[model samples]
Target: MRLPDKTTKMEQAVAAIPDGAAVMLGGFGVPGTPFLLIQELVRQGKRDLTVIKNDANETGMGVDHLLVAGCVSRLITTHLGLNANAIKQMNDATIAVEFCAQGILAERIRAGGAGLRGILTDIGMDTELGAGKPRVTLDGQAWMVETALRADVALLHAAAADTFGNLRYAATARNFNPLMAMAADTVIVEAEQIVAPGALAPDDIHTPGPFVDHVVHIPELTQEYAVVRR
Candidate 1:
């Protein structure tokens, strides 16, 4: 079958995600987050979600929205320092949090996208993060094996996207979006601007259309983060 046109409404996009599904969210903080899609998910009251992200965003924003909605059952991420809610929830045993070293987290997702079993690293070896996990020695060097990370759905934010679903992300916002797009079963991108195919140059495209399953056009944000166009 031919590839389908991926443009979709935000509501319909988030509605397709079921409870208890593993979800990968692309963003370092608020910069590249799919805020509208995340809002819709919270509004829809999705439950038992396993969220995989780089960090738990600040309280009352981003990933914190999901946490506040009590929708997330588990979080696999590198940091949660800025989000006090995540820390409290973890302390309360309300949410399960798995901490991975930053570099290891990225490598794990990259490995998943490349169809590798996992990535081996010595970064956290002998530390709490590596405790109880399997280990292997390569060339006489001890390395902790971090399993590849994959998700049922990935939510991403792009600065611009073509109708065909090709995406481009702004600086800083580009962090995890590209890798997560490749690692998920389905990827839904929220774009500030959507253009016709070929509007985006090949060199400018960060994510090719084939990896994306859906796209929703949002407005652009100014330097101050105010919505400049709606």
Candidate 2:
């Protein structure tokens, strides 16, 4: 189906997501996240979601919205220092947290996109992370093998997207969006601007349309945060 336009609401954009699905979220430090759509998901009371992200919610904002709504069941992230609510929930045994190194997290998603079984890295070796997971030897050396990470759905943010779904991000705002797009079964993008097809220059396209399944414009939500300038 063709992607939705800017006039479409967040509920409409996220309607295809079923309850209890795994979702990979794009953004880091509240910069490029699709907050409006995520808020809508919480409002809809979708439950038991497994989320993969760079970090837990920021201290005062971001993914904590989901945590507060009790929509998330599990989180796989690099750090959890920011969102106090999430920490409290975890400590209370209300949420399950799985920690991974930042680089390893990115590589796992990349491996998912490339159809590889997993990625081998030393970042988690000789620690609690390496003890339980399977290890494999490559070139006579042991590596902490992380499985490829594919989510049932992926939530992404972009600076601009064409009607056909070619996407572009502004500067550092790119973050984990593009990689998550490729690694998910259903890739939904929230954009600040949605133009007619071909409006984005070929050189500026960070993600091609085939990887995107849905697109919706939600510019108002991003105005509160710093966006990458064109």
Candidate 3:
């Protein structure tokens, strides 16, 4: 069957994401996230969601809405420095947080998509990150073993996407979206522009059609102050 288009709306794209489902959100900070779709989920009161992303939304954008709405139960991310509300929630034990280095997190998702069981990395050793996590010995060297991460659904943002689901992202905005697309059972992409098939050069496609299940078009809405330039 063909995939849905960006104009299909967030509700239609996310209808299958249950209350307690696990989700992976695409973005490094706020610039690359599907903010409209996240807002819609908040409006729908979808709670107990386990979200995996790079960081919480900045002060006024991205996943911050979900955090404020209490829609998220757990968060696995590289940083939460920009989100004071999320930090407070984590401190208060309102939400469970799993910290991982950015590179490792992306690799985990890629590994998951590739059907790998887990990965051995020394990035977390001798630190809080490796405290209680599983470890494995590879060639007589102990490495922190992180399991592959997959999600029931993945929410991604793209600069452009075709009706056939091929996606293209702007420079730095290509953060975790591509990996999330591969790791999730259902991939929903929010794009600013929707083009016809083959409009994007094959070499430029960040995420291919087979990995995308749905597309939601959100032409720049109100400008929010949540994103900060690096």
Per-residue alpha-carbon lDDT of candidate 3 for residues 80-103, written as tens digits (9 for 90 to 100): 998899999999999999999889
Q: How would you encode candidate 1's per-residue C-alpha lDDT over 1-230 as one tens digit per residue? A: 44457899888888899999999999887778877778888999999999999999787677998999999999999999998999999999999999988878888988998899898788878778878888898899888888999999999999999988999999899999999999999899999999988889989899999999999988754332333232
Q: How many clashes (backbone N, Cα, C below 3 Å) per candidate?
A: 0, 0, 1
**Residue 190 alpha-carbon offset, candidate 2, angstroms:** 0.6
Model 1, global lDDT: 0.88
Which stretches of model 1 miss by more than 4 angstroms?
A: 1-4, 220-230
The stretch of ten residues in a row with the least summed lDDT in candidate 1 is 221-230
Instruction: Report, for every candidate in turn, its global Cα lDDT versus the true structure.
Output: 0.88, 0.83, 0.86
| TM-score-sorted candidate list, best first | 1, 3, 2
Candidate 2 lDDT tens digits, 1-230: 54444334567768778989999988887677777778778888889999899988665456888898889999999988977898998899899999888988999998998889898788768988787888778899988778999999999889899977799987777889999989999888888888987688888899998888888887576443654343
TM-score per candidate, chains pooled: 0.93, 0.91, 0.93
Better of 1 and 3 by TM-score: 1
Top candidate by lDDT: 1
